[model samples]
Target chain A: MIGGRPDMVDDEHRLKMLMVAGLGGDEAAYRAVLGALARHLRGFFRRRLASRPADCEDLVQETLLAVHTRRHTFDRSQPLTPWVFAIARYKLVDWLRRHARQDALHDPVDEWRNDLAVEGGQEADTARHDVSELLGTLPAKQREPIRLVKLEGLSVVEAAERTGLSVSAVKVGIHRGLKKLAAQFRP
Target chain B: MRTDDLVALLARGAGTEPMAVPARVWAMAVAGGAVAAVALMALMLGVQADLAGKVSTLAWWGKAGFTLAVALPALALITRMARPGSHVGRLPVALAAPVAALWLAAAIQLAGAPPGERLALVLGKTWASCPVWVTVLSLPLLIAALAALRALAPTRLALSGAGAGLFAGAVGALVYTLHCPELDPAFVAVWYVLGIAIPTGLGAAVGPWILRW
Candidate 1:
């Protein structure tokens, strides 16, 4: 019943092919799959998180990462969209659970405007500023690597070179920095 | 970081080799846990004395068959849970079949027995220790199975944990059969079920916490 429609079948087939190729170490296919999943997940979360629209992108990113890390769990025989949607749903449930208390506090009008602003270019600047402010709170060792590798879009090796740290250290810094950043979001 | 950048990084990090298949992972977990449980059983309680004599008996086969039946379905369910959006259709029914059959056998056995012997049939010589030992033995398998589930993605955390626990319980009961001498269908239907239930409850209780990714 899932892919009964022609369009749905095509979408499922295409995503499944890309995913299978991605599992076989095809970087382009993997990137393609991730990009495609991101678009779907953004819409998926936006609809569910309408009251907390600002959190939609964060949930999309989280679900995408989860899908990437848990890629091995995908059974090739199964349809890809369901698997992707399941992960998206799990992330949505988790986010909702975590932010349950904040639900009542959010102003619907403000959130609607925020959602529109995020669609516009100006919100990107505010997001970047907010992210930098968060990075500033981390220790220099953790901050520098995340700022370089994540925020600045540098590879681990490049971040290592810039920070004068070993590649492993840079990776560790990013890992720890992300963990700290995530912890800050928790109550 | 932006979502696009995150995807690019993840794509870059995708290893040349895919992870071991789910079947292989589950096999290793079950095998490893079985070995640990067997070892623990041997250390705590030696195998039943009439080993050669019991092999040909109907009770022995019944006990083993029941445990195996439960284990197989539990295994199937747990594997399904490891994947997202996979249907667990008919698995719960499969898992219940053996239990229902055993209960039927137990009922017949109890009915045929004399009034005074009914309680005795249900409560065999080792009734008190059987479930306890079975639960104790399930610990290692539960740990190993949970670890395996953790390595894979399980969207339904509590269900996955319950599946793992059910698998562990069935396997643990299978391992317990090595040392247990009781053979009454009533005893197995009651005590063994209790033993398996303990871990299933434990798994469900802790699932939301431990299975959090």
Candidate 2:
């Protein structure tokens, strides 16, 4: 019953069985599961960081490494997505935080602007830095939704799909975040 | 890393160390903890003064039964969560409902009782020490349970730790029943629940660090 994708529920069941089988030491199943997860992580990272497609592969690798290293922590009796994505999301946030600071300190004006993409890398960097600062002023509940909807230009339904919140909940988060941002900025 | 290279790398090292089935690990850990708690209580605290007369009452059974009831689901969740990416659906509500029902029942029973007596009902005699003893008694079980979980993968370390702590708290409360003569449902609802919560909190606090691979 989640947004835009009917396959989400099936993926949950498949991932659970795959993980359980993998934990039982089935090598083939384990590979299949990780491969499937790698694909999912690629899409997951790509959607949130559309402006930074080049980094998605690295994020996927990092998340996969986390999954592999922390494999023992998965619960065999629970749905797999929340657990897997929890790590992916954690990695994504960490990546953002680390990158956010470097981008803020460096001036992008000196960098070459690529002509092919709709927005140049430097423009994206400036836009992202400004967005990150704006978002940083809000709490995570509000900040995440604002980034997904207003900054990344995802539809409310799309943002809900990414964040696992309901459409209404995402809307509410954006509303509340903007309210707080507005209050903070007003004279 | 491309998917193929990652897959090849992951599969090369893809094997779990052989370990006991999850059920067995759960049983041994829970049983070991329960035994230790009971033994510690007997060695140090002995039975409550009027236990002989009170042993046959429903209140005594309620005390034991309440703890066992809460412990079972927590044990199942902890055991299941020991494996990576597994879920124990609906088990959390299973743990919470009984606690809620007892509190509601206690409120109804004490509704018409004198106001001062109501205070007596909630505090009982061991209010001060009950929570502390529950945590103390829970230590062995919590240790053993965490040890059991260590062999398996647990991504949600804090949650797994809380489950272990809850399991220990329940069993500790079960053992404490031997020494605690508090018969009022209100007393059990308040103090005994608090006792269970102590380890659950401690587990959450330390879970991310201790259960980390």
Candidate 3:
């Protein structure tokens, strides 16, 4: 399958051919792999984080670089897509971690606060509707703990005290409740 | 850098070392470290005075055998982890079985022994320094493992580091056996495993930093 696919048309096969060639020291094939990978990563990150365009492009570039450096490690037995995307996933996580730390320390100036309020009304309404819909699906045991915890702003111990259950039992109920809610939310 | 520029850059290969197979790189790294550890041990901590006599007993072979057993899964884990997107699926089970088996053996030994003896068996003579020594010995191996990791890509840095550390710990224990006289399976099972765990913990702590591209 290496270098014979002059018109494979499939990304997976094309990528495999390019990787095989690149590892064999074909600069042209290696360049082709990067170009294709860059395009693939753009789509991948864009779908995952549509709100962050700059982050998406930056991540695409980082992932391509990583793939380039780590090309020798790509196992011939495995598919090309997973290896590429795995690097992308790591880059995304690192990016998220870096952004989280920066946000934690960089004081919020609130210059765009009013602008957010003006634009967020529709999104907030949808979010509120979705939350209630999701919360309504749970049983009383699970729902009550969630209400006490998330909705009522009570601590786990307080919620347990109010619910007449042991602390461990309350925690279990909360976990089970969230798990059920998550199942329902899955597409 | 722009994708075009990046491709052109890598294509140029300007002084970049030609990439080798991941397995070969890792094997060389770990193997080199093991040899270095052995050499260092020979120079700084010579073999115990009565290794030959102890070999006739269950202690010497028992320690060496057990250390090799623990090292097996760690080697398998690194083989898979040395590549990007390679799943570490159920590889942990491989690492856990030896520990769990040893622990079970220890518990059984403890159950049969007298209450006074059970305490002594669990805490061997060198409980305080065992972990520290193992950690120190693992540093060289860890560095080599980290060096090997640089050429390949690991998605889970911490997990990969832990694997490398565990491999080194097993190597450390293998070396420690040459000096120490403790023979009880219970002691080897617990303390030697603890020695290994120290490096694994450090690897987990530092992997994110060391393995970053």
For lDDT, the strongest prediction is 1
> What C-alpha lDDT, on a 0 to 100 scale, does residue B32 get in candidate 3?
90
* DockQ head-to-head 1 vs 3, winner: 1
Question: Which of the predicted structures, 1 or 2, would earn the higher TM-score when compared with the native?
Answer: 1
Give lDDT tens digits, candidate 1, residues A82-153.
889987888778777866756668888876776687676633211222456677999998899877766666
Could you tell me the TM-score of candidate 2?
0.62
Q: How well is each residue in B1-213 modelled by candidate 2, as lDDT tens digits?
A: 244554545454344633445566767877788788888999888878888878899878877888999998998888777765466799989998889878887898699788879888788887899888878888899999888877555667889999989998998888888888788888889888999999999888888778754
Tens digit per residue, CA lDDT, model 1, B49-80: 89778879999999999999999999998888
Q: What CAPRI-style quality would you assign to candidate 1?
A: acceptable
Give the share of true interchain contacts found in each model.
Answer: 0.56, 0.35, 0.42
User: What is the lDDT of every predicted structure here?
Assistant: 0.82, 0.74, 0.72
Off by over 4 Å in 2: A1-33, A51-55, A69-187, B1-6, B13-21, B49-53, B80-89, B146-160, B208-213
Tell me which residue pairs clash in candidate 1: none
The better-scoring model by lDDT among 1 and 2 is 1
TM-score of each candidate structure, all chains considered together: 0.84, 0.62, 0.73
